[model samples]
Target: MSVELSVGKKVSVTVPGSSANLGPGFDTLGLAVGIYDTVEVEVIASGLEVEVFGEGQGELPLDGSHLVVKAIRSGLAAADVHAPGLRVVCHNNIPQSRGLGSSAAAAVAGVAAANGLAGFPLSDAQVVQLSSAFEGHPDNAGASVLGGAVVSWTEVPVDGRTEPQFKAVNIPVHSDIKALALVPSFHVSTEAVRRVLPTDITHLDARFNVSRCAVMTVALQQDPSLLWEGTRDRLHQPYRADVMPVTAEWVNRLRNRGYAAYLSGAGPTIMVLGTEDVAQSLLDEAREQGIRVLPLEVAGPVEVKVLK
Candidate 1:
């Protein structure tokens, strides 16, 4: 399909923040939460421009250096479509590098904006594939684009003729499950956390994680009662403790309290999956300990609102 973008067309896309790795799933499972970052784009007469508000106000770049614009350029280039001069506005809430899929949301917002302006040429899977190129992985971007809970994986074609492939599928999660994020004051860089991990692990350790992840998928759909056992991991978090001691500390603390807690994707945020009663007890304890946490339910599907 080929369609030219008119100079005056405008579009807005809202993408949700995601918490990935969900313990043993490791770069494959992600759950979209209520937090969001929105991008509003409009065709203009000249060069790119952006305005930012809320989170990342001073620290995030607002010019062509902005992540949103770069994503849009990437998407347009992938489509072999030329986008006209555009104005992009970002109203952000997802904290960058907080294990909340902020970068994925920005990447998707930009691509979605470009697709909308170009008269919607790319499919959602195509959008995810291009956005994943910017993210270096598909887990977070897949959840952001597909919404709800999802499993994403990469496949490198054995045949040299085809490029590497990304596949994402929405998964069913019982409604009784809820997620609470026990956030910290500081941010942990994804690279920093990854750098701290050991390159190898014992075979037994690998088996333990694989077992839990396998159970976790069925448990989330069939019965959430097993979450306490399902969210266990031995892969990265143990080694990453040195980078963010608080996250490691709380995982032990909350688990000891009988709550299923795990690092929220290279995080300083601990994701607690439980029922409402468990959530209440968590809040009570958090209040007493002076910890900050956000109660989040699974997010709805990603949306594009085009204003004609």
Candidate 2:
């Protein structure tokens, strides 16, 4: 493909919001949803400019300190392509500071937008790499770059810089499997969630999660009826419960009602996978338990799309 030239021009990229670390796949799994954050970038004359219109509206910055701008800079540096000036507009619908992979979406959108405005110089894999650099993890970045449900993980080095390694696998999901997210009013920082978790886990917990993770991965291939078997975990959830008591309570309530629920990322969000028959009841149970719910279907097929 010859370069699609656009000098002193504009381009845009819209990246979907994601939910990561479903149960046993802690720090390694992510599912992209329909909700998105759209970024528009234009080459200009002198400096960087950013505008945010949704989600974090007043709180999100417009300067170089902004996460989107930082990602655009990273992409430019990686591709060695610099514009005279940049005009950026972000239509952000993803919730921030809520374990919903909002930062990852913004980072991927920034990088992808920059790459497009720079004439599609970098490949999709390279775009993933650049976004991963800004966000520091590939789980969410992978899903943002490659849409739908993606199982991904990171490999960081002791020397500081790292490589984000991920493979996009499209799994066929059974119809009844709905991913219901209960986002609490409270916020839990990834750092704070990590702080509350034990640095080292017990061998029993390790073994238990390993077995369940394997089962979960296999279950994705076979049947949604087996979701409960796949969603059980003993490793991270128990230790990270302090920031997620709402998750535990709601999940337990769901299990009792015959639905499978798990912690979505390092959460304040609880995810329950269920059928249409009981989906409403699950939501009702969660609300009855005083937890707020946002019910959405899982994004399937696992294909990557770069919108410009």
Q: Model 1 segments beyond 4 Å from truth?
A: 1-4, 158-163, 278-291
For residues 1-308, write the lDDT of model 1, one tens digit per residue: 43446677899899999989899988898888989888899888777888998889888887887889999987777676775688888999887778989988999899888887776888989988888877678889999888888889998778888866776889988888888887777887888778887888999999999999888888778788899898999998888888788778889988998888999998988888887555476567766665577888888767889896
lDDT of 2 at 75: 78
For candidate 2, what is the TM-score? 0.87
lDDT value, residue 257 of candidate 2: 70
Q: Candidate 1 — worst ten consecutive residues by lDDT sum?
A: 276-285
